[model samples]
Each structure stands twice: as C-alpha cells, then as structure tokens.
Target: MNYPKFRKSAELFGVICGGLLISMPAIPQAVAQESTPKINPCPRIFYEEPHNNQVVVPQGCPPNALTQRLAAQGLLPVPATPSQEQTNLGVGGETPQPSVKLPRPASGDQTQQPSPGAVSSDQPPLLQPRQTPSATIALANGTVNIKLVNDTATNVTFQVIGDTAPRSLAGKSDVTLQGLKAPVTVTFEREDGGQLIVTPQASSEPGNLNVTFNEATNAAQGRSAMRVEPNGSVFLN
Candidate 1:
C-alpha cells in the first residue's frame, strides 16, 4: 500500500510542472525601421497671356533655366505699335497769307491870315518886351526891407538874381534879394498888376545900399536909386 502512495505523489508533481510551463508567454519579435521623407527639388512656374499666342512671365519666376529660356525666346507679350495716322507732323508744310492795311484821312494844308486891327501871326504888333520896374533890398541889423519905385501894385515877388546866390533865399515870404553876396541884378515881379521895383548890389556895410532903377528893356524911363540905412530905413532918390 505504501509503495502505491509514493507513485501517486510523483504523478501529481509532474502535472503541476506542466501547468507552469503552459502559463509562461513566448518573447516578442523586433519592429521594422522607417525611412525619412524626401523633398521635391523643382518649384512651380506660372504664365499669363492677355493676347492670343503671347505669354507673359510674371515677376515671381525664379532665375532657373526654364524661365531664362522663355524670356530669351520672347514667349512674353510685346507692346502694340501706334498707327501712322496718329503721328504728329510739324507745321512746315503750310503757307502763310499776307495782311493788308487801310489808308488814313488827310489833314488841312492851306494857310490863313487875320484882318487889319486883328492880332496877326505875321508881323505881330511888336509887343515891346514887358518893361520891368526897379526894386531895392536893404539889409540892416537882422531885418531886410524891400522897396519899389513907381510901383502902383501891392503884391510882388522878389528873388535874388545871381548864380552865386543861394539857389533860393531863406526866411522871407517872397524871395529875398539881399542875400546876393556878389554884384547881382535882383528882379522884382508883380503877381497881379505892373509895379516898379528897385534892386541894389551887394554892399560891404549897412551904411547905404544904393541901387539904380531903370526900365529893363527901355533904359530911358530915366534912372532912380534907393538908399538903405543901417537902421532898416529905405530912402528913394
């Protein structure tokens, strides 16, 4: 009986070893390696054609062989030529016309004369040159006294009559004849009516500045002289 028990135990141990062997899994196989993606070497090219059979390469095309060939062969469009009728020829071919001027009117050509007793241009009544009167200028202290002989009028303008005198006299309503330093012929003119004026030459001192008055043109209405005292008093002789 004991020998059979020993045989049973050996069978049990063999069954358990078989079960362990079945539970263990087999080793996995190695995965296959992947290759890298390769990039395309050439870029795309686009062409535009506004006219038939005329291709235009836009700016973006690269300077590769294909683009250079297209540009050299003139596959690109060409600008149109202008018609001959639209051209500008200068004015060199035209002729100019002549302009005409009209004649002017004629003026009077005959000479006319005035009758007797009327003023005549030929042999006009010899208007004796106007007779100028005698005038005198007296310089005493700081005052100047102007006197006229046979002067019927009141308003008169007297001026120094020499180039050496100041171009114009100073400090007088009318022109001052006393400022003439050299021997000057002073002239007295009447503004309204005829009057006599006596003008004297330059004097050394104020004692007596005497000037003779005579008709400027006639010289014969006799002569008159005026004496000027140092006290601004004027005496006619």
Candidate 2:
C-alpha cells in the first residue's frame, strides 16, 4: 500500500479499537450493602452480687433493644417502693394563690362583668392549691426540675420528653432537666452487658422528680427502676 494510505489505515484501526474499549461494559464495583443488625433475645435480670441484681444479654446482641424499651413503659422491672414512700408525689394541702379579692356579688345577683379569661363555675379545681412550692412543684419560671443520677458501674443511654435517640450518661454522673414546656417520660436503659438501673426517689411534689441509678445487684427486683412517668405516677413491674 502507499505510505499515506497505510498510515491512514493504521490510525483508523487505532480509533476503532479505542472506541470499542470505551464502549465496553465496566466491571461492577463492590456495592457496599448495609449489614443488618443481629437480632437480640429477651433480657434477663440476674443476681450479680449477694445483695444486688442486674439485667444483661450476650455479646453480638443489639444494644438496648429489648429490655430498655420495656422499662420505659412500666411493663418490666419497676421499683418496689414507688407508692409507699413517705413523700407524696402529686398530692398536697391547699394553699391559696395570692390574688386581689373582689367584693362579693350581692346574694341572688348573678349579673356581673366576668373577669378577663375567667371561667365562672362551681366545680372545684382538679388540682387543689399546692402548699408553698415543694420540690416537685413547678418553679417560679414555670420549668419543672428533674434530676437524674447514674450510680451504676456501666454507661447508660436515656431518652426524655419523647426524644427517640438515647443520650449517653457516664457512671457516677448526674443530669438535671429544666425549662421543659411539657411533662416528659424519662427512660434510662443499660448498655449491652450492663446490670444496673435508675430509680426515682420520692419528691416533695410532682414537678420535680428525683432519681438515682443504682447497682443492679443492690436494687430490688421490680422495684428500683427508671424515673417516674411525667404524669406523676409510679409503675411497679
């Protein structure tokens, strides 16, 4: 072949081979599939010490899966002394709020300008007047104060006021909740292989609930537990 024609043919072959290589299917990259979490079995509470008990499961189990959620609902392992304690949670004596006493309407005279935002009714208040603010009562700023202390050896995860993600609390630590607009359920769950739990002690009132996370071996089965519900009731499980 002529020199020019031969060179042109070689260039064409090179271009065609390059195009074919470019159009070929690529080798599949390894697709990174998310692994499924292993299923965990029901948790068990066992005696860790002569005087204490703990709830735990084996390794490779999903952390905080089965038992922690149950504890938050009052369905499992509630404290034994929720109601019997000397302190009354939501109950109290009547103490009238400071107010400007208006002149009494003359007997049988029902017609009067109603106070702004006042509902005139004979029905009594569902909550009787609280005596001077005790510990559990709402504060002057209207935030209910709650204190949680972790007294166990292992770390724990907790949720408050309907939050789904659990926050970690180190052992021998304390946390207080303030400035919450609504009542909340506080749940504390032991991490996998953990044994201890949190318990709510009696408070002076309902707005400020105090709790302690103590050793599982030292706790009363079905008695020592997570904090009381936001509604001011204790659950025994």
Candidate 3:
C-alpha cells in the first residue's frame, strides 16, 4: 500500500465529517425557530364599566382605523373572538348567551286554573246583602231620670242645670240624678283640663236617661253638654 496516499484520503474524509456535523446543527436550529409561535406584546386590555359592560381596547398597541371608526360611532368594545379551544368544544363556534327560565303554570294546556274560593273571570262577583234598618219607637211624655256614668281616667265635675247641684265623680264611677225635668242641660269639665265626651247609651226605659262620659284626645270630639229632651230624646254638644 502507498502510505502517503492513504493519509491524504483519511484527511479528506475527516473534513467532510466536520462539515456534515456543522450543517446538521444549523438545520435543527432553523426548524426550531420556524416552529416557535410569535406572541403579540400588546394584547387587548379589558375593563368593566359602571354599567357592568366590558370595555376592550389595545391601549398601548398601534391604533387601527377600524377600531377608531367603531369607537367614534359609540360602538366600542366589540365582542371578543372565540378561542380555538372554545371553537372545537362542539358548540358550533358560538358562545352560549345567558338565559333566564321563568316558572310556568302547572296546567298542561298552558292555561292557569282558578284557585279554590277564587272568583271566576267570566262571572260577576257576588255583592254584600243590604242590611235591614230597625224601627225607632217614640217615647211617652214623663219626668226624665238621668244616670251619669264616668268611664274616664281623670276626675270629672258635672252640673245638671236647675235639677241637681254640681258634683264631682271620680274615674270609673257612676252617679244617678233623679227626677230631672224635660229639656235637661248638663255641663261637664275635667279636673286636669283634658277633654270630655258625652254619649247617650240608652233611652229604652220610659222616663230614664242613661249617659256615659268618656275621655277623649281629639279636641273636635270632646263635647261638654248633654240635653235630655221632653220626649226622652238626647243630644250632646
């Protein structure tokens, strides 16, 4: 064998191997760079408004004419694009909007039935019956006997004009003034400068007068006088 010739062939083989190694690394690096995804430094900024609407904008990004036109027309913050994952989720690439389901009537025919004791819609409502009035019987002519009852919280003084002297009846007390003439006048005043109310309770008995004096708070309702008429009719003033 020629030794010098073999040495020259071996040197050429080593040079080819070194070139292949350097070229192989460059191919892998180019492929890796092409496979890497590019990311935008300025993604959309999202913020909530006072009305709970989301406002989206590319705040620090380059301005686009379409985005500026929509914003000028008061139609800013358009809906976000559905992502690739959401598109492939079998929802037909549409985001489902929120919905509210109201309660329906129980009837299968879609018409609500009237509840128990409820008035029918087609029928007229029943009215209350008219009350029958009682007959008023006239009293016979006689001397009137007056009974005064004080159902109050304070002491009251009353005077029957020309029949009995002025008398003071305590709280929750009663007094009888006998044989008062027709057209009897009685005046009452409270010891505490409060108010007094006089009401005639009964004249059912012949020649008998039954009256009650009650305390009152309203100035319009506080009356001071009671008059017994000749025919047993009563009046308060």
Please, what is the whole-model Cα lDDT of each candidate in the order they appear? 0.39, 0.52, 0.68
The TM-score obtained by model 1 is 0.20
Per-residue lDDT of model 3, residues 110-131, tens digit only: 8766899988889987899853
Query: Scored by Cα lDDT, where does model 1 land?
Result: 0.39
The TM-scores, one per candidate, come to: 0.20, 0.33, 0.40
- Superposed model 1: Cα runs more than 4 Å off: 1-153, 163-179, 197-237
Model 2, span 117-218: residue lDDT tens: 887686586887643321233332444566778777777777774644678888889888764543455566677444554455555754665777766653
**Residue pairs that clash (backbone atoms under 3 angstroms), model 1:** 134-197, 134-198, 135-197, 135-198, 135-199, 136-198, 136-199
Cα deviation at 204, candidate 2, in Å, is 4.9
Between prediction 1 and prediction 2, the one with superior TM-score is 2
lDDT of 2: 0.52
The weakest ten consecutive residues by lDDT in model 2 span 85-94
Error of 2 at 15 (Å): 99
Error of 3 at 167 (Å): 0.9
In model 2, the runs with Cα more than 4 Å from the true position are: 1-143, 181-183, 203-206, 218-231
At residue 171, candidate 1 shows an lDDT of 22
Best model number under lDDT: 3
lDDT of 1 by residue, 75-178 (tens): 64332332232122111212234457655544564454466678755665667864333333344444442332323324444444433332322122333233
